[model samples]
Target chain A: MNSITSNVFGPAKSINVARVLLCLEEVGAEYELVHMDLFQAKEQKSPEHLARNPFGLVPALQDGDLVLFEARAIAKYVLRKYKTEQADLLREGDPEEAAMVDVWTEVEAHQYHQALRLIMLECFLNPTLRGLPTNQAVVDEAVEKTKKVLEIYEARLSEHRYLAGDFFSFADLNHFASTFYIVDATPYGSLLDSYPRVKAWWEDLMSRPSFKKISANMTTK
Target chain B: MNSITSNVFGPAKSINVARVLLCLEEVGAEYELVHMDLFQAKEQKSPEHLARNPFGLVPALQDGDLVLFEARAIAKYVLRKYKTEQADLLREGDPEEAAMVDVWTEVEAHQYHQALRLIMLECFLNPTLRGLPTNQAVVDEAVEKTKKVLEIYEARLSEHRYLAGDFFSFADLNHFASTFYIVDATPYGSLLDSYPRVKAWWEDLMSRPSFKKISANMTTK
Candidate 1:
């Protein structure tokens, strides 16, 4: 049995789960991705998983007696534990570069998450489950906001190769996950097409061996 | 000149600034707090302050040549730079304990920030500035969500003394700022009173020498 087990759900459909899986691939660590049945609410709310993650969320990682949840945290832990030359790929040695990584990661958590989640809720969750009226105004507002954030990325990518400077860090991975979702779901998906720098950035990220490896094996339910 | 200089606006009554101040006090670092004239739109949007924080937010920190704008990030850096006993406070010695600290800090960033910001906007910002009708429904929903989050904290506090366990770390300080605002502004304020464990937990936090120093010196705009 693998020492590290990642508990995930909703198929390979979830960007959050993809984050940890991709990080594991980046570290070249042997781990098992355990798919949880979200429909049955079985794996998530199970007593064992609850002990690992009180929130009953997927993408929880367990290593021996240490249990960790939150995709970014797990990614950082894996990188630190494995201590690869790819350290610069996730975090830099310099404090300034590290701070830049923190900044973009926060950007992912706050702005990107905010815009992407709203678009997802409007497009999929509300339409199928919540029975809420679709507000074009809200959707437009989200698109505009997402465009503004992407413009920030576009400008940054114009100057640097990756989100956190010259290195292809997990910060890039974080944005890739959210932006991929945005392109799939939002009307503003075409906005990335206009930002040539950002388009190149995405293309380069998707070409990574780790991303390709994990994403290829992903099971979409 | 002091090593740290912070631009303050949006009222010294801001929980965000309070968090930074608490951290500065914890590290016993000398700083100059310049009150931004928020009413006149003087400090936040001023070219100088905007350079310090592109988001035009208050509590931007300048440490010599390296300037950081986010309050939480600044607080973490302050502790890291000044505290000799970092391992004890931040749980740095053991990977498991350190992971717990990191997880709770992420929780502060993800869950606590969302709930607090929503309540703040609904309770204060919309009604006061936007001339929108105070949406009790929005605020009530936020309160309910906050209650669930606090319930998690309550259970944790029942077993441990602080948010990250027995150690009185910055996790408590990070939460103190937001929770202080919630206690003052919401009916959920009374909810904390019911959780004797949480109440005891908070009391211990407030009694910290750092908390005392920061609270005493806070200038209310």
Candidate 2:
């Protein structure tokens, strides 16, 4: 009655979209990826897509009667519903361990992802994706912010293998998509070299079979 | 050995701090509210506080060996650890119901709080708290963004009593602190009146004894 292969819809190379895709791969969940053209068709803002996420974002999941959005939330749902070998990614049964995951996840969302998003929008997204010139001032501001956040991560990674103790949690996985783009498409990748531990942690994440698989699909499509 | 009275540290009247405080009250957890001055003494950046949260933000929770930050994360930790009648506030045992809670919780953080924060920072916080002039342009952009989000909330609220469902969940509870300050301190409060369901939802949240008690404590100190 259950198939790990789920139907997921969103644009390719989207950091948010890749999050859901990465999770599907991480759990060995079989899933069909449907890509929508955000630039040409403007499909995400379409009434149909809006119904799934009124915020008009992408990477909506459809499974039976359930429709979910928000990459992080959908990741959590997938983690909760699909208990594969990676079932303990959230440190589910342990309250203390789970709290660490939650704390770092919050940091990644509110601080790290935010800083990276601004840098992305001002650099590659604005200049390449939208035909707008790069805004060096905004890039500088975001880079400074990201540097501070990575400093904290560097110290944390110095002691813990992952964001949550020695085990990799959703917090570690959550950093995959956006940082992938940073390391691939932007000059901000250079900043990581200064943070040896954060650099190593990120290297480990990028090398994960799940992240590698999802990212490969992103470019091929 | 279990005292609902938990020790919470942070600046007063902060939306994040209030989230932790609100949850403590809702879950019937006994918590001691410790206020730090953000301005003047600028204690949040103090070395001691930085030890609790490497990021130096609050409200930080101290229970035995646990030192957790991020109001949403702390709120979840509080909910998980302290089981009162409100143990079900997270919809813990039911996957589908918890998914709804998780989805809206994501909305509150990434979308709703973000737009409202810009509006608050430009309209009131800068002028009143920082002695800086209000930036009407930023305020206009934030208000426009917030209106779209409220429109979505209006449609959702028309169908359900709360963000998650009929029963009050943390998703509903999470809206309390920020919306209170919006209605009380910012002109954006007027924006809510336009969306009856949204306004009604806010009213319901504000009327909660926990919220009222916390907000009261904010001004008293």
Candidate 3:
């Protein structure tokens, strides 16, 4: 705890890294960000990186002796360990509220990210990383699917101030970083404009200090 | 609370539904299982069903006034509300242990399920659901990927009894149901036999009363 040895290993442009950084900001924790060149170096698949995460993915966290991978897990760790006086990100104490938070968080991971990732890869990474032309068919399909997922978000946001309920929790932050990247980094980002409530919710969450601080340090591409 | 209105809506053979049902059994909760024929009825996408789950997926839980979807979310809800006197399915009070649990649970959803599902669809569900032949190439690729994942599991289980430590938690149960299907219903089922530690851990978890009871009631096909 003295030295804040916990570090996040990944590129700043990574939505997953951005996800963890938002949680760290929410918990007001001091930690180091170790940048790995995911494209040029292919460092994530290196033996050194695989030791931290067997899946060879990034945003792995090293906290003391506990090494953890998976951005959601890392976020849960920060929210649990470095809990701030401001608000509980995971709603740890209230089981019911926490359960709701857990539902939306998983939904973000399973449902929302599923579609957004397709859009990102087809629209953003295809052009940025591989220098390939955007496949219109892929983008069109992804936009259609992502819009369906966001329609649910639009309905849920209409009912609750945030995804889980009236409060801002990790559920909202979970979607924030990914949505930021999908919208800003990808050409299909404009698809979000169709879902009025979802777009408004995105704007509201992005304006928060947690996202604002992280955004200052992140690169879209 | 009066009538135990928690109902899980999905086909009995579904891995996601099986995951939630296992948690319900661990909690010793009485719940209704509403079987929906995905091929014939297709009720999961019906207007009534979409009201509960926007993603139009099965394993949606309607508990009292709170309607929830996403199998992991429903599992969290069951663990929180219907908690039994036996042992906490989730390490509720211990933040560190719970964080570890969260990590593995997400791994089950993200890393393990990603590959396992591919194997299931290609090797198992194709023949059963669609009367299609197993795609050997896809199955081979998935088997290779899943073995890599299980290698990490084998290493971890060698050190600890379960994924998130010794105690039986949702982290273990989350894996139990999916793995039960993959091993029993797929060509790559024997692949698990190669990883001794993971196999032993899987067998140990399967032998638990919670799993034994759920397995008796589940329909694999």
Please list all clashing residue pairs in model 1, or write none if there are none: A89-A169
How many clashes in each candidate? 1, 9, 0
Report interface Cα RMSD per prediction.
1.8, 0.8, 1.5
Give each prediction's DockQ, rounded to 2 decimals: 0.46, 0.81, 0.72
Give the CAPRI rating of model 1. acceptable
Clashing pairs in 3: none
Per-residue lDDT tens digits for candidate 1, residues A6-88, read 44332455677788777777777777777777655567788877777777777788787777887777777776666576444
Candidate 1 local lDDT, residue A177: 60
Which 10 consecutive positions of candidate 3 chain B have the poorest summed lDDT? B212-221
Model 3 agreement with the true structure over B67-176: per-residue lDDT tens digits:
88888888887887776657587886777788889889888887898888888887778888899998888888888888889989988898888889988888988887
Residue pairs clashing, model 2: A4-A30, A5-A30, A5-A31, A6-A31, B4-B30, B5-B30, B5-B31, B6-B30, B6-B31
Candidate 2 wrongly placed segments (more than 4 Å): A219-221, B219-221
Model 1 chain A: ten consecutive residues of lowest lDDT: A1-10
